[model samples]
Target: MNEPAQHMDVGAYALGVLDAAEAARFEEHLADCSRCAAELDSALGLTPLLADLKESAPDPGVLIARPRPALLDGLLARVVTVRRAQRTRRLCLAAAAGVLIVAGPLAGSSFTSQNAPSHSTVSAAKAMYEEGEKIGAVDPTTKVDASVSLQEKPWGTHVALKLANVRGPLTCDLVAVGRNGERQTVTTWAVPAAGYGLQGAGADKWSKEPLYTHGGAALNRNDIDRFEVRTLDGKLLDTIKV
Candidate 1:
C-alpha cells in the first residue's frame, strides 16, 4: 500500500486502537515519516486535553468553532518523501551483501517508546530499556551506546535491547548475512518507547519478570564490524565497519 493509505490509520495508532499487525505498521511508518511522528506526537498529547476542553467549554447557546490549519495534505507529502527514501535504500541494499550487527544508545532517556502499547502485547521498549541491570546485562563501551540483555532457555538467547536515539528514529531492520553471502532476514519495526521482546530462532518469547530501572548493565566490547541499522526500504542509518 501507499504511504498515505498506510498512515491513514495514524489516529487509530495514537489512540492505541490498532491490533498487532496494524500497530506495528504505523510504528514503522512513524519512525520514517518524521512529519507524521511529530504531528501524531502533538495530536496524541492534545487528545486528553481536548477531552478536558469538551468538559469545560461554553454552553451550546454560545458555541465557538475553533479555526485550525488543515494538515492532511502536508502530512501526506511528508509520508511520500519518507517512502521514497526507504525505497531508494531498499534498492541499493538489494545488491549488497554482509553479516549484520545492531547497536544503539542506551544511556539517554531511560528507554521509552514514543507510542505506548496496550496491556496485551509486551512493551518491547520498556523491557529492553530495563533488562540490563536486572539480569544478563551487557557492558557498554565508550563508542557503544546501548546494552543487550540475554537469557538462556532451551533455545538460543532471549534478547532485549536498550539503545539510544541521539538523532532521529531508531526504526531499523535486521538481516543475517551468512558466509556464502545468503541474507537471512530478521525483522524491524517502530521501536517501542521502553523496550521490546525478541522471539528469534531460539528464544521464542519474553519472560514475565520486571525490568531493572537502575545501573547494572554494561556494554560489550566486540566491535560489531558488520552490524548495521537501516530503514525498511534499506537506507543505512548506522554501520559498524570493523
Candidate 2:
C-alpha cells in the first residue's frame, strides 16, 4: 500500500473498525514504520474521548423521525471534531503555561522568606486511605473495586486512585468534599477499554499516574472530609472518607 493509504488506515485500526485481515496488514506495517506507529498511538489515546462522545450522543429518534446516518460515519465525524477541538485546547493551554513560566520569577520573590512554611505544608500531608476502606458499588449489577490515596500539599491535594472491574471507556471525576460541605473537583481522567481488564474479567488495574489539583479554591487535605468517584454525567460510583 502507498504511504498515504497506510496512514489513512491508522484511525480505523485504532478504532477497531478495520476488518481482521486489513488490521493484520496494518499492524505489520506499523511494526516497521515509526511515523505510522506514532500516529496509531495518538489515535489510541483518543479512544476514551470518542467512547464518551458516543455514550453522550443524543438518540436519533429523539431528534427527528428520519433515517440516521451509519454508525461508522457518525463516529468518524465525531472523532474528527474532537481531534480538532483537542488541538485548539492544547494550543491554549500551552500559551497559558508559558505565561506562568514567565511570571514564576516575580511570584517566587514574594514567597522567598516563607519557603519553609510551604515545605512544611507538603510534609505534613498524609495519605487519606492509610486504613482500608470499602469500595462502594455505583451500579448494582457491576462489581467494582477501587482505592484512593491523597497527600496534602501547599497548593492542593494530590490524588492516587486504583480501580478494577470498572468498565471503560469511561470518564471519571474525583471530587473532594470539605468539612464545610463545599465540593471541589480535584481532577478528571479518561480510562481506555483495555484498562477495564482482559476479556472483561475483573483484574487489577492501576491509573497511569497520580493527578494533582491546585489553587485557593481547591481542596486541602485537612479540610477534606470525603472523596467521591463519579462519572462525567454525575453518577456516583464510589466514595471514601478521610
Candidate 3:
C-alpha cells in the first residue's frame, strides 16, 4: 500500500472500526512490512493520550463572561432546546404509565381475570417456526452432540460450537439454542464438512467455527451462558452450559 493509504488506515485500526476483511488485509500487509507496522503501533499507542485542544477551555476568567458569535450562540441554544424536548417526551411517557397503573382497578373490576389466549398468537409462532425451517435445514445424522466454546477478545466475544454426528443430507436445518433460551436455526449453507459451526445472536449467515463478533452486536455477548446443538429432527444433540 502507498504511504498515504497506510497513514489513513492506521486510524481505523486504532479505533477498531476496520471490518473483518479489512483487518485481515492490513495484518497481511503488516506481516510483510515491518516499517509500516511499527509506525501504526506507535500511532495507536499515542492516540488515547492525545487531547483535543479545540475542546479544551481557556483559563478561568473573572465573571466568566465573553462575547460569542451569533451563529455559535444559536447553535448552542438549539442543541439545548432539543435536549429539553426529548426529556419532556420521556417524562410524558412515564406519567402515562403511572396513570395506567393507578387506573387499572377502576377500568375493570375483573381485569385480573380477563386473561385470554388468542389463536393468532399461536399462528404467529407456527409461522415463525415454518420460516425458520425454510431458512434453516436440519442435518441428517438425526443424533447430535452440542458443545459451545467462548473466548474473550479485545473488541468483543467469540464463540465456537461443535455439532457432532449430525446425519448427512440434512446438515442444513440444525438450530442451536444459546444460554438465553433464544433459538438460532442453521441454514443449509452454514455447515461445512467440519462438524462445528460458529453462531451468534442476529447472525445473518452461519459459518463453520470461530464465529466473528463485533462487541456482541451480531450476538448477545451477555447471554452467552451455554451452547445447545440440536438436530433437524428436533432432537437434542448436546449442550454445554457456561
Residue-pair clashes per candidate: 23, 0, 14
RMSD of each: 20.2, 20.7, 21.0
Candidate 1 overall lDDT versus native = 0.42
Error of 3 at 211 (Å): 14
Candidate 3 segments whose C-alpha is farther than 4 A from its true place: 1-143, 153-156, 172-180, 185-222
TM agreement with the true structure for every prediction: 0.26, 0.37, 0.24
Any runs in candidate 1 off by more than 4 Å, and if so which? 1-125, 128-146, 169-171, 176-182, 191-227, 239-242
Candidate 3 vs. true structure, TM-score: 0.24
Q: What is the alpha-carbon lDDT of model 3 when measured against the actual structure?
A: 0.43
Best by lDDT: 2
Task: Supply candidate 1's per-residue lDDT for 72.
Answer: 35
User: What is the number of residue pairs that collide in model 2?
Assistant: 0
Instruction: Identify the runs in model 2 with alpha carbons over 4 angstroms from their true place.
Output: 1-142, 197-217
Q: What is the lDDT of every predicted structure here?
A: 0.42, 0.59, 0.43
